[model samples]
Target: MKKWLTIALFIFSSSVLFAQKSVKMHPVIDTAKAKWGKIKIVNGTAMTSSNDIVENINLSKDYSLLVTAIEDAGLTQTFKSKGPITFFAPTNQAFSKLPAGEMDTLLKPSHKYDLNYLITYHAIAGKLTVKDIQRKINANKGEATFRTIAGVILTAKIDVNRNIILIDENGGESVISNFDIQQSNGIMHIVSSVLVPKTKVL
Candidate 1:
């Protein structure tokens, strides 16, 4: 009888230990499993691989000019901080179009404020998708005034044939070449021309 009781007790203790192990292991697996659908793995140091805002910008070759301009203007840290900023980033071609030596002059330390103002003038406080702009334009009878973070008001209008155009303070127009480059904190819209704010808009 003693032998039988001892075996039974041993079995019960082993079962309890197994149950505890199972409980702990099960919870770990449950927590480790992703609830969302299968995630695709992105390889390499490309911006499209990550959804992080600053990282994505750093990775993108397309925004090299914009990135250089931002660095030259000393606004890199400012932009990296807590921004769901809408950046109207100009491409390399756009930057090349600047008047002879203008780009070089803007990059100088003395012209830091001018560069900052120009760059920040292109950014808005929130992440505005192209759809949002369209909606706003529709609501405003096909014309909308978008106020930039730099205190400049940009005019968005749809032409008679329905092409979307962004008119600068000087009445020079730039068409949004690429729309909705989404990021974690904001969106980037690639434009053909650099936007310069007018004194009145500033």
Candidate 2:
């Protein structure tokens, strides 16, 4: 185990020392860095650009069920694509909040369309950080709408405490628990609940 750790440390150091000059940092990246600093990999399971979004999820113990569902839905390639997408990732506990058997039924092969829809609904085009989301809220006079990759429209607003709240098509709201998990492909914000589309939430 010590030897493995040593090798991983060396590889991590090498990547930082020779990062690609061509890769441009998103404006949000610099902002995130100011707040979160350079992410330090602990046991090869950190949310650094050293790994993409999927890789981070795979490394996370909290997202095991989500990873499996993404694979089963056949939407892995889309998440792996060269993108700067904004993803609202739900934790395992969030999924667990669903009605009994709901998630399992969606993961079945017969429900690929439903599974894909749910997964895609969690993502939006481009890299939208917390600031961007708030800006959209201002532009819309306190509530802004975003079209998910699944073609479902969701609304964003801020509560009294200034917490960004996302309202799904069915009027269900989910809170962003952790914001700005940066990956090579894009950024993800951890949400406390799954935002179901109008069709599913109803």
Candidate 3:
């Protein structure tokens, strides 16, 4: 009788410990839900999978360059932090558009400012959805100026057909191909081409 009681007590304690560990090990899903809500615009196709934003991006090959650049810039912690940042994430092709050998140079540890500025320039503070962008354009009479975190003002416009367009200082323009990629801390908008700052327009 004594042996049976001891075994039952041990099993109960073990079960409780396992249950606590399981709860603690659950994946973070709040961020995923926030992303879904933030990116309902530009279509939430990406959010249709698991409700884990980081997990979703990790599973995506299309965002490889963006991921790599973020890692190179040491911005993983910043992006993962408690933010509602709006990221204008460039695709692999966008990075490829960089001048020959420039990408490698920028990725070097010595060129931290260039890489940091380039990445931060693509980000805007706060959580801006596609509708918010459209509304801003309409409020500004079809055009608005957005100041990036890097202190550069970018021109935003909507055409007569309601397509969103961004014009850099160098008279170059790129359309926001994918809008409203929601994340826990912020949102992401995918652009087709890379955005080179006016200072780096050469």
- TM-score of each candidate? 0.71, 0.77, 0.71
lDDT tens digits, residues 28-135, model 2? 678777775457453345676646778789887888888988999998888888897899999899999989999989988999989899889999989999999999
lDDT of 3 by residue, 57-143 (tens): 555677677777777888777777676678787777778877899988888999867887778788788888889998888898878
Worst 10 residues of 3 by lDDT: 42-51
Candidate 2 local Cα displacement, residue 81, angstroms: 0.9
- Each prediction's RMSD over C-alphas, in Å, is 8.0, 12.5, 9.5
Cα RMSD, model 3: 9.5
- The model with the greatest lDDT is 2
The whole-model C-alpha lDDT of candidate 2 against the native structure comes to: 0.85
lDDT value for model 1? 0.75
Worst 10 residues of 1 by lDDT: 36-45
lDDT of 1 by residue, 15-86 (tens): 999999989877854553344222222223333312534556666576677788888888887677677888
Which prediction has the highest TM-score against the true structure? 2
